[model samples]
Target: MTATARPAEKPAMPHFSSGPCAKRPGWSVEALKGAAVGRSHRAKVGKTKLAQAIDLTRDVLQVPADWRIGIVPASDTGAVEMAMWSLLGERPLDLLAWESFGSGWVTDALKQLKLKDAREIKAGYGKLPDLSAVNFDHDVVFTWNGTTSGVRVPNGDFIPADREGLTICDATSAAFAQRLPFDKLDVVTFSWQKVLGGEAAHGMLILSPRAVERLETYKPAWPLPKIFRLTSGGKLIEGIFKGETINTPSMLAVEDYIDALQWAKSVGGLDGLVARADANTKAIADFVAKVDFLDFLAEVPETRSNTSVCLTFKDPAVASLDDAGQQAFVKAFTGFLEKEGVAYDIAGYRDAPPGLRIWCGATVETADVEALMPWLAFAFEKTKTEMAQAA
Candidate 1:
C-alpha cells in the first residue's frame, strides 16, 4: 500500500515591513542575476547606467529642470547627515520631530553639531508636532512622511513661498508613493529600499537651486568628511549630481535600482505608483472600520499616510490585560500568522505603543492584503483562546 503524501503548504503572504518593503509582483531572480557584479563602479558602463537611472527618475518624478540629483554614500540617514553637516550653519534652524527618524535628526543637531539656537518642536509617536507654530524664517527640517508613526504632511501649501529660510526634507519613504512639491523644497533625500523596493546601502540627494547657492557661498564651521563634501574651494562639484558618485558604489545595487526605476516608468510613473499605495491603505482602512478591536493610529484622516499604516487595539475588553499581557497577546497573534504563513514582520516598533505597523507602499498588492485580513481575525481569536487558558 502506497503512503499518502502530505498536503503542500501555502506560500507566505506578501510581506509588509515598513523598510525593505515588498517588491513588485512578478519580480524575478533572473532579472537580479543579470545585474552588473564585481565591476568597477567608476567604469564608463557603470557611469552610463547610473546617469540613465537619474535621468529616468527625473522624468518619472517630474523633477524641476534646475534641481540636481546625486548618488551619495549611506542610505537615507547618510544623505540627511551630509546635508545637515554641510549647509545648516548658514542660518538659524527649526527641527521638527514626531517619530524615531525625526528624533534622530534632532539628536544630531543638539548633541553632534551642538547648534545652540536651533528650535525643536517634538511630539510622541502616532502624532505630528504642530506645524502651524513653526517659524519659516529659520531653516526648516522635517520628514515628509513619518514611517514609524504613519503621519505625513499632507501637502507643501503650508510652506510660505517668500520665506527666506531653506527647507530640507527627509523623504525616504514618501518619494515614490506621494506627491512631492519640489518648488517648496530645498534639499530632499531618499533611499532605494523604501517604496521603490530595491537594494539598500545608497541614498539619493536632490538639491534645489537655493541649496546649491548655499553650498557655493556659505561654509559650515564643521569639518567636512569626504563623503559629505559637495564643494571644493567655494566652487560646486557639479558632476557629482550628474552621476559622478563621491566614492565607489555597488554596481549590482545600482543596476537593481535601475530595474526598479524602469519598472516604475513602465507602470505609468508617479501617479500610478501613488494609486497602488493608496489602494493598499484603503484596504487597511476598510478593515479597521469594521473591526471593533482595531483603530488607526493616525488621529486625523487628512494626516493619515498612504504608505505606512499603523493600527492599535481599541476594545475595552482587552484593556483589562496588563501591559505585559497586552504585549504577549500581540506577540501571540503575530506569531500565529507567521506560523500559518499569512504575514511576516507585522510587529510594532519598539519605541511606539504596542500595535502593528504595515507597509502599504506601491509594490504591495491590495489583493494580497485583502486575503490576509481573515487570517488576522483567525490569529486574534487564537490569541484570546491562549490568554484565557493562561488565566
Candidate 2:
C-alpha cells in the first residue's frame, strides 16, 4: 500500500499516554498557583486543602457515607500493596488477571505474599476471565480496568452482593471515566495521574465499612511496613481518613488534584466526565470501523475500555509477522505520528502485544482524537509503504 496524504489538521494537544494521561482541557501552570508549598502538612491550611480534596472526591465519586477514603503514600501501587499486605491471608483468595497490571498482582500474591491457597484465574490479552466461576466466598482481587489490553469489566454484575469476603480492586484507569459500583467493591485503589490527569506520587484508597471491619478484626501473619500500616492496636486509624497522612505528602500534587476535581465538577461532574470519555472512544471506534487493517484489541464490544483504547493491525501482512517484527512496525508507525506532531506515547505497553494504545480519558478532548484518526491513517500507510519498499 502507498502512503496516504498527510493529514491537514493535527490534534491541538498530542499527548495520548495511558498513564500521566492528558491533562484536563484548558489546564495550565496557573492551576497550581494555590498550592500550599513550603508549609508543614500538619498546619491547618495544608490539612484543610487535603480534607477538601477528600470531600470533593467523595462528592464526585458519590461514595457511600459510611465508607472511608484516604490519601495514602506512593501511587496506586502503594494503595494496592497496602490492602494486600494488610487485608489478605485471613480468608481464601481468588486472583483474577487478564493483562499486565492484573498479572502483577497475581505474582505478588503467589511469590511475594506467598499465599498458598490463593486461586488464580487468567485469560489472554484481549479476553476476560470467567467471572461466573469466581468464588465470592473467598477474597477477590482484580483490576476493574485492564489498562494494557483495553478490556474493562462492563459492570459490577459479576460481583456477588452478599459475598462473605472482600473485593479488592485496582481501578487506577477506570475511576473517573467508568461507573464503579461502590457498594459492590470493598477495597478500591487509584492514582492521581489516571482519569483525572493530576500530578503523580499520590494514591487514593477507598474502603467500605466491611473492609474496615476486616482490618480491625484480622491481622496478617507477615511483618507490615510502616507505610502500609492502616491500623493501630487493632483499631482503624481514623487520622489517615481525615487528612493526617502516615508520611508527608506533596502539597503541590494535592493542589493539582483539587484543580482536576474542580474541572471535573465544572464539566458536569461524574456524568459529564463519563460522557466526554465515551465520546472520545466513540470517535476512535468510528474510525477503526472504517479501516479494514485496524481493529480494537478488545474482541468484545461490551467489555471494551473507553479510557485506554488499544488497537491492533489486523492486515494479513502485518499479523503474519512475528512479535519482534510487529513491534518494529509499531515503532515506525508511532514514530511517524510523533514526528508529525499528531500523537505521542501511542504505542502499546511493553508487556502487551504490539499495537497502539490511545488514552480517551475525560482530559482528552474528542476533537483531538478525531483529528488524530487521519494522522493515524497517514502513519499506517506511510509505514506500510516503507516496509514494502525495504522488502
Candidate 3:
C-alpha cells in the first residue's frame, strides 16, 4: 500500500489512446467477415451495406429523420474542412479555440480559408472562452469536446434557439457519449474511431436543413475541391446522403462501423454509451477526489469531459515545475506504466499543457479504468523518487 509499491493488479486491457481508441468489448477482425472487400463500393451489395450503415447510424444515434447524414472522407478533419470551406465566407465568423483541434479550425479560418471577418474567441488549455462573447449573428464553429484538454461545453444552453447563423460543431470525441442539442446545431461532425472505437480514415457529416439550404444557395468565392463539394448544379446532391460517398471508401471500414452501430443498439444506444462513459470518468474522478496529488485539468467540474478525462499534478512539487520539467516528469511516470503494459498513450498532448489525458469513451471498460488508479498513484511516486535521487 506504500506509495513506492507497485499495484498487485494491472488493467486487463490498457489500450486507452484518445483516438482510434479501444475497440468495443469482444471486437475482432472476424466482425468484418461480411465486408464487400473485393467489389467496388458502387456495387449493389456494397451500396446496400453503405446504406444500411447510414440507417443503423440514424437508429442508434437517434438522429432526426430530416437531417442529412453522410459518410465523408478524411475523418473529422475532412468533415470540418468541408463545412468551413463551403459555408463560412457567406457571413462573418466566430471561431472558438480551447484545445489543439479547435485551434486548428481557427488556423483554417484565418490562414487557409483566409476569411478576413473571422474572430477567434479562445481560452487556455483547461478553460473555455466566454460564451457571452459569441456573436451568433455570424457563423460559429467550435468543438463540442476538447479531446486534447479534457474539457467540453457543459451543454447547448448557451446557444439560442433562434440563432441567425449556422452552428458547425466538431463532435468527434463527444458524439454518442454526450447529449448533443441537434435542434440548435446546423452541422455536426464526428468519426467512428472515437467513442464507438471503429476504424479510422472516415468522417460522419450530419447537416440540418439550414446547412443544406446554404450549400445549395451559396458558392464560396474560392474554388471547391471535388472532395469537399456537397452540391451539383446549385442543388444539394442527394446521393451522398444515401451512401454515395464523394470518392471510393474502404468497404471494410464501413462494415466495421455497421458492426459497431449494431453493438451500440444492443446496449441501449446513445443513452447506454453516455452511461458507460460517465461511469468510466467517475472511476478516475473518485480517485482524484481522494488524492492530493492529482486534479482535473478542466477548471470547472461541469466543463470536464467525461470521455477524454485530462488530469494535472496538483502537488506543489510537481505543479511548480517548469513546462519542460513537468513534461519530463510525465515521460518518466508514463514510462513506468507503459513498460508494465498497464497503460499506454496517457500522456498529455504535445500542444496542450503538461498533464495526463485518459480516454474514458464508451468502448473503454470502467473496471479497467478503476484498475488503473492505483498504478497511476504508484507511478507518480516512483517517478518523483527517482527524479529526486537523480537531481
All models, RMSD in angstroms: 4.4, 0.8, 1.0
| Prediction 3 TM-score vs. true | 0.99
Candidate 3 segments whose C-alpha is farther than 4 A from its true place: 1-4
Give all TM-scores, in the order shown: 0.95, 0.99, 0.99
lDDT digits (tens) for residues 1-391 of candidate 2? 4557887899999999998989889999999999999998999999999999999999998888999999998899999999999999999999999999999999999999999989999999999999998999999999999999999999999998999999999999999999999999999999999999998889999999999999999999999989999999999999999999989999999999999999999999999999999999999999998988899999999999999999999988899999999999999999888887889999999999999999999999999999999888888887888998998
Error of 2 at 67 (Å): 0.7
Please list the C-alpha lDDT of all candidates, in the order they appear.
Answer: 0.85, 0.95, 0.93
Question: For this target, which candidate reaches the highest lDDT against the unseen true structure?
Answer: 2
Error of 1 at 213 (Å): 0.4
Clashes of 3: 0
Screening candidate 3 with a backbone cut-off below 3 angstroms (N, C-alpha, C), the clashing residue pairs are none
Model 1 alpha-carbon drift over 4 Å, by segment = 1-13, 320-322
Q: What order do you get sorting by TM-score, best first?
A: 2, 3, 1
Which lDDT tens digits does candidate 3 get at residues 1-391?
4545678999999988998899999899999999999998888998999899999988877889999999999999999999999998999999999999999999999999999988999999899999899989999999999999998999999899889899999999999999998998999999999999999999999999999999998989999999999999999989999989999999999999998998998888999999999999999989999888999999999999999999999889899999999999999998888999999999999998898999999999999999999999888888888988988
lDDT-wise, the better of 2 and 3 is 2
